[model samples]
Target: MDLASYAELAIELVNSSDPAEDSLRDLDSLQRLLRIRPHLGGRVTRRDLDAMRELRDSLRAVFTAAARGDHADAVDRLNTLLIQHPVQPQLSGHDGQCWHLHLTESGSVPDRYAAGAAMGLAVLISDRGVDRLGVCAAEGCGNVFFDTTVDRSRRHCSPQCAGRSNGIP
Candidate 1:
């Protein structure tokens, strides 16, 4: 899988829940997330769901710190997670695609997921700077985002949020 796509796993996990509601509220929700991220699949259970929730909170803090200009805190958080959930890198290719780097398919479902997400975030921060990580500016919509804009002016998580913030709907 693409490393950047793995970074998206981190963003998705952080956005999965907020003060208003939680998408990963049950095993089915967790399964749904896994379905989208086929690279991170295993025999998940309720325990894994709880673990993922905890990981989500941890990742959110990282993004929050980065988006707020606390680069040290963000790096520290990613480092801690990297240490906690080490990933083994390997080259893989299938479906007639070119060979690329991928994290090992070992460990429990949560661990594997955490490893990829944390590693992806770490790589992104190191490569593009922590400012690329941001939280949505839309009111009451605090979803995190990996800003890929040329000018780095992305403020909202999605165009829908931007429109909603601008009263377009």
Candidate 2:
């Protein structure tokens, strides 16, 4: 799978929760989450859901460390994660069509999530820069997002946050 996709998942997972409530609060939420994230799809169990939540927390720590300009700290945290949930990349294709790279899909939910998310962050840091990761700049909101924009002008996680912060409403 594309490492960029994994990076995207890391950001989305970190931002999934707000002060209002935990978004991954039930199996239905997990199903919805998987529906959007086809790569993270499979027969997820209650244990898998719990593991996914743990992975989300771990990714949050990684993003938080990166956003604070502590690249070394972020790398260290990521190293620990990489150690725990190592990614096994392999080439795969369907019906002898186009071959593509994919990480090992066989593992616990947290293991798979961690492997992909870690590899994605590593790729982002190596190919782009540690500065590519960020937490939202909007006051009172701490959502995380990966900065893929060329000019790196992103600050708020979305335009809604930007509007609220700038008092556009």
Candidate 3:
């Protein structure tokens, strides 16, 4: 998926506030989605997990800024992240994947994941602009979301979250 798609998925992965029995499971599911492309790196170590957590926080900030229509701020935040961990696009493998860019150099899983996400966000901001990012409107749940829907009316990070917020027991 492109940056826009990845960004949306990233938002969904981190914004959940649920602390129930299934919350960790839900998080794991979301992480799988984010790491769909093996190039983004999969869970491999404690440092990787920590890096993912940091990326989650950074992504949250990006989305929150976007929700407020703060494009400059969001871009600045992305830039800072990029500086800390620069990305160099490289071509590898030959399964007709055809030289898709990678976000990080060969290193830790977390570094790879963070680089991939940063690269995705960079693409999103550069191509579609940062206005596409958003936050869930559900009261008391400030989860962030990416507006990938055709109508761009996405309010909640997930359907379940949306339903719960709406009192749709």
Which candidate wins on TM-score?
1
Q: Write the per-residue lDDT of candidate 3 for residues 47-72, one digit (tens) a residue.
A: 55555667778878887887888888
Candidate 1 lDDT, 1-169, residue by residue in tens: 7776688889989998865657688888788888877777777888898899999999999989988899899999999999999998888888888999888578888899999999888888878889999999999899999988999999999999999988999
Global Cα lDDT for candidate 1: 0.88
True-vs-predicted CA distance for residue 76, candidate 1, Å:
0.4
Per-residue lDDT, model 2, residue 47, is 88
Model 3 weakest 10-residue run by lDDT: 16-25
Model 1 CA deviation exceeding 4 Å by range: 18-21
Consecutive 10-residue window with the lowest summed lDDT within model 1: 17-26
The CA lDDT of each predicted structure is 0.88, 0.81, 0.65
lDDT of 2 by residue, 20-129 (tens): 76668987887777687666677878988888888888888888888888989888988898898888887878667688877756786667777888888888888988
The lDDT leader among the candidates is 1
With a 3 Å backbone cut-off (N, CA, C), the pairs that clash in candidate 3 are none
- By TM-score: ranked, best first: 1, 2, 3
Write the number of the candidate with greater TM-score, choosing between 2 and 3. Answer: 2
